[model samples]
Every structure is written in C-alpha cells, then in structure tokens.
Target chain A: MSNKKIGCGCLGCSIPLLTFIILLVIILPLSIFGVMNGAFGSKGIPAPKVELPAEVIFHIGVFPVTNTIITSWITVALLILMALLVTRKPKLIPGRLQSAVEAIIEWMYNFCKDVAGEVKGRKFFPVVTTIFLFVLINALLNLVPGYGTWPITNYAGHEVILLRGANTDINTAAALAVIAFIFIEFWGFKFNGLGYLKKFFTVERAFKGWGKVFHGKLSGFGDVLFGAIDTIVGLLELLLEFVRLLSFTFRLFGNMTGGEILILILFFLLGFAGFGFVQVGYIFEMLVGVVQALIFAGLTLVFATMASEHHGEEEH
Target chain B: MNIFDKLAELGFSWPTLVAQIVNFIVLLVMLYFFAYKPVMKMLDQRAQKIKDSLDETQKIKDQAAVAEQDFKKRLEVASKEGQEVIARAMRSGEEARQRAQQEAKVEAQAVVEKARQEIQHERDEAIGELRQEFADLTIVAAEKVITKSLNKNDHQKLIEQVLAESTTLNKKA
Candidate 1:
C-alpha cells in the first residue's frame, strides 16, 4: 500500500469560513434590523436592574424561607425521587436510568480516587458527590423559564421573582462552605490527633528545639531563626483556612448570581435580539454550572485529603 | 453602621443561614443513603458478577480443554494397545504354525523309518526260505542226474553253487 497523507485541505476550511462570512454579512444584519423594527417598533428596550437578594417566598416559624430555598427543596426532592427510581429494583443487568446513574457514580468515584487516595476517597465520596449533585441541579434550575420570571408577592410595590437558584443565595453557599470546612477540620483531628493543632500553632516547637540545642540536635542560631519563621508561617496558614472558607462561599455565590444577572441584563437590552443572546448565555451558564460543581466537589475532596495527611510527607 | 448590619443588608440572616445549614444537612443525608450508597453498591455487585462470570467461563473452557487432552491420550493408548495385540497374535500364530509343521515332519519320518525296517525284515525272511528250497531242489536234481548214486559232497557243492548264482542275479536286478 502507498503511504498517503489523509487530511482536510484548504477547501474544507474555506467552505465553513465562506458560509460564516455570508451569514455575518447578510443574514445577521438583516435579522438584527428586523428584530429591532418589527419587535420593538417605536418603544425601545428598557434598562434592567439586577436583584441581588433572594425573594422571600414564605415564613417558616421565625425563619423567612426564600424562593431559592424552595427551589433547592424541590431540586432535592426530584433528586431523591430519581435516586429511588434508579435504585428501586436494581438488577445485575441495568436499565437506562440505572446505567446512567451508575455511570455518574463510577465517574465520581474515579474522580475522587484521583483527587484523594483510594481509602480516604471512599470516605469523602458521598459528601463530595452530594455537593456536586446539589450545586449542579440547583444551578440548572436557574435556566427554567418560570424560575425567576414568575411573580409571587409584591416587594416595594413591584412584583418579585418567585424562584431563584439556590447557590445564588449567600446563606446557602456559606452553609455549604461551612459544612465542608467542618468536615475538613474533623478529618484533620481524626487523622492527626493533637498534632492537627500544631499545623496552626507551631511556635511551641521553637521552644522545644531551643531545649534540644542543649542536647546537640538543633544546636545552631540559624535553626532557631528558621524555627521562628516557620512558626509565623504556620500562623499564616491558619489564617488561610478562613480564607478558604470565604473563597468557597463567594466563588459559588458570585458565579451563579452573576449568570442570573447577566441573563436578566441581556433580556433587557435589544428586547427580541437579546433572546438569542440569552440562549447563548444560558448554554455558557450551564457549562459554568457543571464546571463549578466539579471544582467545588474536587476541591473539597482535595482539602479533606490534605487535612488528613502529615504536612511533611511527599504526596504519593 | 456595624459590619453585621451591612452583611444583613446583603440578605445575610442568621436564622436563614441556620435553616440553610439544616437544609444542606438533610440533603446530604438523604443523598448519601438514597443515591450514593445504593449506586456504589450496585456498581460493585455488577462488577463482581461480571468477574465471576468471566472466571466461570474460563474455568469451564479449561476443563473442556483438559477433557479433550485426556480423550486424545486415551485414544492414542487404545490404538497403541490394539496394534500391540495384533502384533502379538501374529507372532504367536507364526510360532504355532512352525511348531505344527516340525511335529508333522518328525512323525512322518519316524513312521517311514519303522515301515522300512519291517519291510527289510520280511524280505530277509523270504530270501532265507527261498535259499533253503533252492538248496534242496539242487540236491534232488544232482541225485537224479547222477542216477548211479554220486557222493553227498557233490550234492552239497551243487547247492552252494546255486545259492551263489541266485545272490549274484539278485544283485544285478
């Protein structure tokens, strides 16, 4: 057989480029003018205002249950029902739903195993997977038409959005971050015992080493200075733990809330023209939602694994 | 204004946070039991079953291969035994035929020797009787020829001469 290079030539690339140019030059401008003239007529599109706070849907005892919380509750319920459907009568030979669920779980398990080693990965799997599912499902709820558009009650004489993404609520994001932080600390204590405290308060080691100088183990001025610096760094590391909590909260809250706000703004500008733009934004938001979920779950598992390990050991 | 007030303006209610925490905890617990645990268990069981089936198939194939080899070996042994039996029978048959031929030859030779001996004895007896009659006839002929009563010595000499002549004739025949 003769050796031949099999690849698309310049013609293949030019065809798509030519098609794109034609659309951009003709169809795109025409469509924009048509939407502006036909849809808006004389009335121009209005300026949009983004609402940052979640709307209160109801009051439960002393707590004001927001629309985001309601959406989360529904999401959780649907997720639970899906879980029951898949696992109700599990067979060795799986059905479509069961197989899809199994594939997701297997993927998560493998991902966790890569982030955390096998033993700790199994321990962290459920929490990490739950966080991913909750975030992803809650994020997807934002894309539904009636989610934020449906009016519930009058807020300051204007109708308010009834449903919102759960993670867009600062309280929910903070809660999730706090839960993850608690689990990280718990694992640190469980694995390292009293040594876990030394990661934050390592100044005691300097004093201990000072005594060790008499025994000729750490018998240098440089060693003492280095130990002091190490102690200060350990304190900084302790501060960073709080930073991690803040980052986890704000990152999720900002991304989800920003996407919602961007969609609203897009809908306000150019009226009908913005509809196609919002569809594109929705797709981007969906991707961002999935990415955020993976990042959150992956980071939590990594932090948990790191907390459980000795600081001095090289990771395997 | 306090930082707490500023945060509260951002929809940060302590009660709502607590409720959200409760909600997350509930979600986590429910998801763990209903989704993660069961799904992982089913996957593990399915994996185990697949492994077991593969192992079982491998074991059966190996057993079949072993049985095939055993059958082949038995066939070889049976064919070898059959060949050996035929070879032994042929050898024994050849030996039996040779032994029977040698016995027949010996028996015939013994019978022929016995019959020849008997024939020789009977011929010798007949020859003796003929000799004796010839002698008596010769003596009577001599007496008649010599009517004048010749001597007994002459008659005896005549018989002996006739007997010698008969022996010579028999030798010539």
Candidate 2:
C-alpha cells in the first residue's frame, strides 16, 4: 500500500533542470557573442538546423543504417538494461525502481482494460504498451544535449548529422502505424472472422431483404438506392482506413520534427533572450510527447476493440 | 517538384521501413518474454500472497472468537452450578438444624420424665416410712392407756377395727 516510485539513483531529478538552464541561459549566449566577435576565430556561430531526413551513419552491404535507427537502438538498449536492473531480483515487496516500473505498466494495463474490454484488452495490451513506450522514449530523447547535434562524415564524404529522435523520422512513424494497422486488422479477422469485412464492404447488406422490397413492389426502388449509396459509403470508409495510416505517420512525425525545428530556430535567433520561450516550448514538447503517445495507443486500442466486436454487438 | 517527389527525396525507403519494423518486433518479443511476463507474474504472486495471508488472519480471528464464546459459556455454567451447590448446602444445613433441635427437645423431655419418676419413687418410699412410724406411735399410745393384756382373737379384731378407724380418720383429715 505504501509503494512509491523512486527515480533512478544515478541522476538526481534536478539534473535536467540544471542542464536546460546552463545550456540555454549561459552557453548559448556565450557562444553567440564569442562567435560573432571572432573569439574562436575563422568560423562563425554554427546555426542549429533540422535535417528532414535522418542521415545514414554507416552501411552494411547495400543497406544504409541511419542515425535515427541508431538512436532507436540506443533507446532499446537503455530500456532493456533498465528492465534487467529492475527485474534482476523480483520480490513480493517491490523496491523503488521495480515499483516505478510496475506503476507505469499497471497504469497502461488498466487503461487498456478500460478502453478495450478485459478479454480483448489483454490480447492487444503488449503491442499497445510497447508502442506507447517506444514513441514516448523516442520523443523525449530529442531533449538530450548531444542528440541530433552530432556530426559525422558519411561514405559519400559529406557531413551528415548523427543521432535524431526516432519518432521524428517519417519512416519510423510509418512503420509503427503500419504495424498497428496490421494488428487492428488481424484482431478484426480473429474475432469476427469473415464478418469483419462487412464493415468495409456493404455489398451483402445491399442485397439483404431484397425479396421483401420486390414483394412490396414499386417501393423496391428506395431500398435499391439506399443500398447502393450505403455500399459506396462503405467503399469510402475502406479508403479512409488507408488514410488513417498516413495520419498516424504524419501526426507523430510532424509534432516531433516540428518541435525540433522550433527549438533550433528559437535558440538560433533569440539566443539568451529566448530562454523563457524555449523553456515553454520544451514543456509543451514534453506534454505533446506524452499526449501523442497516449493518442496513438488509445487509437490502436479503440480500433482493436472495434474490430473485434460485431456490428450490432452493443449499443454505442 | 510535387509532394510525392519531395517525399521520395526524403529517403522513404521500403527497406528502411522493413528494417524498422523488424527492429520493433525484436524489441516487442524481447520485452514481452524477459520483462513483461516476469514482472506481471511476480506482481500476481505478491497479490495472491497478500490475499492468502489476509484470509488466514481472518480464519484465526474467527476461531479465537469462537473459543472466547465457548469460554464465556463455560464460565456462566460453572457459576450457575456453584450457586446451585450453595443453595443445596443451605437447604441441607436448614434440615440438619431442624433435626438437631427436635432431637434435643426429645432428649430433654426424656430426662425430665426420668427425673420425675425418680422423685415419685423417693416420695413413695418416704411416705411409706412415715405411715409405718405413725402406726407404731398409735400402738404404743394404746398400750399405755389400757395397762392390760388381751386374748389372741379379741386382740386381732380390736387392732383391725382400730386400723380401719385410723384410715378413715386419715382420709377425713
């Protein structure tokens, strides 16, 4: 009953606050003035830029390994290490790290149970929770000092930035959305079997009770027209499903990338004067990160639950 | 260039998407097996342990309550029995007192009767001696008055008549 979440002991909670203040208030202005006055000589201030595409860090055969992918790998490694550390010794009475980890998973599990019914909730719980953590971690990783600031020479002899937010990359977001979409579809098939397709194609519903319409005579026209339109609407809805993929991808990619660009521009233009603005932006970006993660997971859970249910299984 | 061309220029490679998917799947599988499963299992076990201990405590409490009730019931019975025993002893004591009182009264009556009988016998003896003394006195007096001897049959008849006259005189007095 008294279980509390204690932060990882390695870094104090104030470290992040201290880091932001030092970077934005002190180092930024100092670098700006020093560079403008030619204190470092030759080169002027290296203005922060947001590269749209993640640069390839290295190659394995013909395949290009990008910096965002590397960041993702780092995220995965850190998460796995954290997992191992917390779970190394499991106890009935959980310690700080274990309690913190359990609290988060418990919250996500409860959220899933609330949105999806208990049975289907557990079925999609793993993927939904995973997506949430991955997105949230990737989003927050952008706040790190050296993240997306590292520069390296590619095999093409051009300077390419190394290490960016994984979710900021459109490809990564697209892949995540695709996976969620696929799972939603899979759950739809699993629960409703062939009946799941009826939501997408209304051709069968169009023909249903056609005999009654004919027997009623002359009134058959209304039913035919209604059915046709209904089928057409179903087709449009089917098309919209693909649109969902694009929206999911862009929503995550735009927010993260836009935040990155905004931070860069604000830091470059205002320097010290923009400290308050940048802080506000940073807080906003953090909220957005959590919100977007929640939305993505929530949407996936809704879709999975919807897919698993029959058309008239329950009232709205 | 249009939007599609711009997107193509952004390195929207299928290979990269596939790679990212593969990376994610690997992460999912790893986390599910190593992290989520073990942690969830431990949490469930802890919950179950707590529930079982709570149940055991409740059972013990109920048993204790039952024992307390039994003890109270026995105490009440014992107290009732003690009161009954005391009442019985009191009743027996009352009976014994009555029996002893009746026996003492009877013994006193018997002693009084024996004392009365002894007094009567002593009185009877004293009365008989007195009567004999009176008869002897009368004879001596008669002998002094007459100064002569009488014949045998005449003497007996005269003594009898005198004795009868003396008895009648004693009764009248």
Candidate 3:
C-alpha cells in the first residue's frame, strides 16, 4: 500500500517484476482461455471457453486502430505515465522510486564494467543497455491481453489480435541479431584494419612449425609448409566468422520461438499446463526469453570487445 | 508478371504493407516515448547516485584515517608529558631526601655540643671544689699548730669535710 516496495531484498528489481507478475495473472488466463475457445488451434478437453464478453466487438472501422489497439495504446501509455510519475524531477536525496531506479542503474553499470572494460563500457552502453531495455519492455508488453480482440474482429466476431511478442516473431529476433552483428563487425573494422582478419586465421604461434620458427630459421621448406598451414587457418577464420553470425541469429531465434511456441502450446495443445491458476511455466517462458535476449546482447559485447582488443597478444 | 498480377488480384496491396510498417513505426516510437526515455533517465540517475555514494564512502574513510592519526599523535604527546612528570617527581624526591639528611646531621651536632658543654661544666665545678678544699686544709693545719689545740681542730676539720662533700654532691645531682 505504501510507496515503498513490499520486500526488503531486491525491492528495486522485484517491484517492477511484481507488477509484471500481476499483469500476467490477468492477461495469461484471458488469452489462454481465448485461445482454447477455438481462437487458436485446439486439443480435446473442452471447457465452455469463457469467451471475453464482446468488449465492444473488434473494430468495425476501416483503420487498424480500434478497441484492441486502444488497449495496447493504453498499455504503452501506462508504461510511459508510470515512468514519468516515478522519475521526472530528480531529488538530491532519493525517495523510494528513485532508489529502485538506482538499483537497476548500479546493476547495469556493474554488468558493463564486468563484460566490457570502462572505455568499452561507455561506448557499448548506448547499444547494450538499449537492447536490454527493448527486450525487457517488449517481454512485458507481450504479457498484455485483449490484443487480437479489442481492435479487429476475426470471422467468428472475435477480437483481432494484432500485436504480439516482438522477439517471438522470427523477423524481429533475426533483424535484431543481424543489426547487432553488423554493428559489432563495423566497430571491429573501425578499430582493426583489413589484416585483423589474419589474427583469427593462421594458427602461426600455436603450432609454431616445431619452434625452429622462433629461431628465425625461415628455410624454404618451412616457409612453404607454414604458408599452407596459414592458408588453412585463414579459411578456418572465415568459416568461423560465418558460424558466429549463424549462431548469433540462430540462438535468439530459437529461444524466442521456443518461448512463444511453449506458451501457445500450453494454452491450446497442452491445457494441463495452464489448468487452474498453476500456469507458472508461462512466467518461466518469459524469463527464458529475457535470458535469451540478454545472451544475445552479451555475445555482441564479447565479440565487439574481442574484435577491438589488441590482436597480437591473442596469438601467444 | 501475370502471376504477380493474379496475387495482387487476390488482394495483397502495397498500401497495407505501408500501413503495417507505419503501425510498426508508430508502435516503436510510442514505446520509445513511453518506456525508453524514463528507463534511461532512471538508469542514468541511479548510476550517478551509486557513484556518488561510493565517493562519499571514500571521503568518510579518509576522514576516519585522519582522525586516527591525530589520536595517535595526541597519545604520543600525552605519553611524553607523563614521563616528564615522573622524572620531575623523582628529582624532587631526591632533593627532599638530601635536605632531610642535612637537617638530621645538624641536629646531631647540636645534641653533641650540648652534651660536651654539660660535661665541661661538671668538670669545672669539681676542680673548683677540689682547689677550695686544698686551701682550707692548709689553713686548718696552720691554726692547729699556732693555737696548740689538737682535738678541737680535728673536730672543726671533720665538719668542714662534711660540708664540702654535701655541696659537691649537690652539684653532681
């Protein structure tokens, strides 16, 4: 009831998290029930799907914006209003909301410090922190219900759901990953010239042609053999870059798709998962999605940091 | 081109795609306005506060260190002053002891001098009595021979001896 967050521990992180949890309680059941009511694919066990009584039957208007869209807008508006009300004017000595915000800031600062050194930390903050926030808010937004219903009607007079989990959409995840990869590569190229590619290729120091190479005995045979080895290593480096890109794209896609499918399957395919109020795995699904996004962001930083780092020492 | 036209005939319109893009863009913008700005501001402020707190903690530690050093300095000074006080007390004690010893020596000399004076007075008194007795004896002898009365003279001389002995005893007491 008080402005203060209920629990003493991690009250900062926990309060916003609790709000999301409450939202889940409302939207999760409603959407699942909606889906079970033949809005989505179905299994056998049939409850008389408690159809959300026509909340002014999805938009009859020509435009996409309607009741469902309005709700989405409200959700967005609520998020904005809360932020403004909590933050806006900074206090020298903070109240509860300020303290909660500060906790997140400290967490992020430490995260940046640990992953990227201070200089890279500052540079990466804009992108990395932005990604973190984007994924998080989107995840929360996906928890919102009445999306398909409130705006546009399906053929059976149901609300047409327009918006969904942005990351859950393959297009969104793939796009984000690709953009992040491109940015990382850009930073790499900016820092290290064309021959930075050589660092990955050419397993020069590791095999070392039996250490006589260190003795500077560049015999003709040694040169030829090492050159072949270098060429192969260079090919491997090129292969590895492709692999990095694929994995980056694949990882984000897999996690988000899995989370979305899991939730959908839970409601329509496996009703037992959402039976009663024991639909907790949905939250876990949300958590998994968040972790996936974080992993993606973290990988970007790692690649960026490594690419920008001094290359010569990496060989040794 | 005929197949594309047929698909278009099936009602896929560029306007819809544009509208969807517009919808997406609007959503993104709305999200940015709603969530991103506040979150970022919150984050920035929080970060600054944490840094400030850490700096404050460092300042407190510095002050504590200074205070500790000052306390140690004061203790050292107090210890030095304590030693000086002890040394002064010991020196004064020694001087008082010497003064008391000197006073005792003077008192002993005075006692000795008074005893010596008493002994000299007693010796003088005894010598004066002895000299007077000798003169009286000579005078008694001359009277006995001149008058030719031996018994009366003997009696007078005996009485005189008794009187001299009594006065000498009184002086000794």
How does each model score on TM-score?
0.73, 0.74, 0.50
Candidate 3 ranges with C-alpha deviation above 4 Å: A1-87, A90-121, A144-265, A268-280, A295-316, B1-104, B107-115, B122-173
Better lDDT candidate (1, 3): 1
How does candidate 1 score on lDDT? 0.81
Clashes of 3: 9
The global C-alpha lDDT for each of the candidates, from Candidate 1 onward, is 0.81, 0.81, 0.60
Per-residue CA lDDT of model 2 for A59-104, tens digit only, reads 8998989888888888888777778887878777888989998888
Q: How accurate is candidate 3 locally (lDDT)?
A: 0.60
**What lDDT tens digits, residue by residue, belong to model 3 across residues A1-316?**
3424555665544668867776777767766675556433343433333222112223345543323233334444554455566557756567897667556545665677788788777666555654565556556666666432224555457654455454443334444555566667777777777657666566554355546566776654476586677778778866776678667645665665565555555555445434543356567866875787578767777877877776775445
Query: Candidate 2: where are CA atoms >4 Å away?
Result: A1-45, A205-216, A273-276, A312-316, B1-4, B46-58, B92-173
lDDT of 3 at A195: 52
- Two-chain DockQ for model 2: 0.40
* Fnat of candidates, each listed: 0.71, 0.46, 0.08
TM-score of chain A considered alone, across all candidate predictions: 0.83, 0.83, 0.62
Cα misplacement distance, residue A193 of candidate 1 (Å): 1.3
lDDT of 1 by residue, A218-311 (tens): 4655567777998899899899888998899889999988888787677666456444576898899999999999989988998899888886
Give candidate 3's error at residue B64 in angstroms: 6.7
| All models, RMSD in angstroms | 8.3, 9.6, 12.2
**Colliding residue pairs in candidate 3:** A59-A151, A67-A150, A68-A150, A68-A151, A148-A159, A148-A160, A148-A161, A149-A159, A152-A160
CA shift of A175, model 1, Å: 1.3
Best by DockQ: 1
